[model samples]
Target: MIELREHERKTLLIVERLDGKASVEQVINESGLSDAAVMRAALTLQEKKLVKMKEKKQTIAKLNKEGKLYAERQLPERRILDVLYKMGGEALLSNIPKEVDISSNAVSVALGWLVKKNWAVINQKKGTIALVESLLTQKPKKGADEKLLELLAEKDTVVIEELDKNPQQAVATLKRRKLVETKEKSTYELELTKKGWKLVKKGLEVAEEVTLLTPELIITKKWRETKLRKFDVTASGPAVYPGKVHPLQQIIQRAREIFLEMGFTEIRGPLVETAFWNFDALFQPQDHPAREMMDTFYLA
Candidate 1:
């Protein structure tokens, strides 16, 4: 006969009910044990040669915050394509940045995907983007990347294997765009040994664990019937790192406070300032390279 703790016995019973094999998620749901408790019990069972833990590493796809926003609002590339179709199937490259209402930085990304899908083509000399007649007239369809994003939005995360088709290429495309991120996680499944199965088949019961002693229980003389909860004072619990502001932000705040105390006022400048303020106000040379188009951002 082997010695078993209350939690170990409970965990074994749940695993036995699951046909001798179950994932940690399944065990947690069925056994009603906290994650730490279940993991501790699994380790104890493994040491006793009662259960073997098998781990499978799987790549899962999940949408980031930006992806969620994109899912709600159609992708920038799709929006660009829609606007191009409405505007006689062609538009100047410069007009697209303002017309599509998408960030100027994303224009190139949208154009690249538009060309890749054969939905549109860019005329470098004319600085215009035109639809591919052969593809535009046939029909509009969502690409694999867009489809994957919609699916991920519905389900926060999905295993690569669960994808319908062309998972590798589809994931590669989304990964490149940074719309979705992939994480490798180990999924653990516990298998019961012959000895464990036999032991669990004998049946088990949930132990009574009381959290508090009440005066009513003592008055009713039911103290002997109550089982107190077990606590391991020697075992270290989880570490906690309290929330704190970023070091850089703290330093900036302190500097701001010091300046105010010294009767100094801070003035903020607009991000997009004309050359008049940037160059003329500072008495900078107009012919300086820093004032050139290559070195400066000009507001249209």
Candidate 2:
């Protein structure tokens, strides 16, 4: 006869009832056991050579903050194209903001995507943007990225396998643009081995086992009636790394404390400043090398 714990016995019975093959979720629902508990029992059964476990990996996609916003409002490129179409199919790049509600920072991004998707063209020397002539006659269709965004908006999460039209490329583009995120998910399927079936044909016993000996149990003398659970001392425990302050933050804090001890008062000001306040107001010449594009970091 094979000896089993209560949860293990329950899991095996459910697997057998499922025709010797069952998914972790199926067992979880039928047995009313938590995911972790079911997985633990499955692992123990595998260790005893009673069952075989197979793991399948899948990619799940979800929209991030930017993706949600873009999905609600049309993408920047799409909005720009609509505005250009309204302006007789051509407009100066600087004049687009007056016609559309897109942000100044997003104008460049929209322009890039417009040219990339062949929906519009940009004249860099002339500083103008024009929609493709074909778009003027025919209604433009949504790109794969746009379609994926709409799908994600309707449903918060989607499995990559369920998507059509070469989702891998679309997912990669969305991920690069910081609009969508993908994570790997694993599902386990358990099947009974011949040995497992033979054990089922014979008889098995499940006894109440105690993993911990508490003071109440000791006082009540119940420990004597329950079987103590077996432990594998050779197994390693989970790795732990205690948290500590970052080195740079530690240095900054120490400097602040030292300045306070020296009887100095601390003052705070805005971390960012406009060009006038940062350079022009300080009598810095516009032609100065420090103000050049390559030397300076400019915010859009």
lDDT winner among the candidates? 2
- Residue pairs clashing, model 2: none
lDDT of 1 by residue, 71-95 (tens): 8887888999888878888899999
Those runs of model 2 whose alpha carbons end farther than 4 Å from true positions after fitting are 17-19, 161-165, 197-300
Off by over 4 Å in 1: 209-300
In candidate 2, how many Å is residue 195 off? Answer: 2.7
> Which residue pairs show backbone clashes in model 1?
none
What is the model-wide C-alpha lDDT for candidate 1?
A: 0.85
What C-alpha lDDT values do all the predictions have?
Answer: 0.85, 0.88
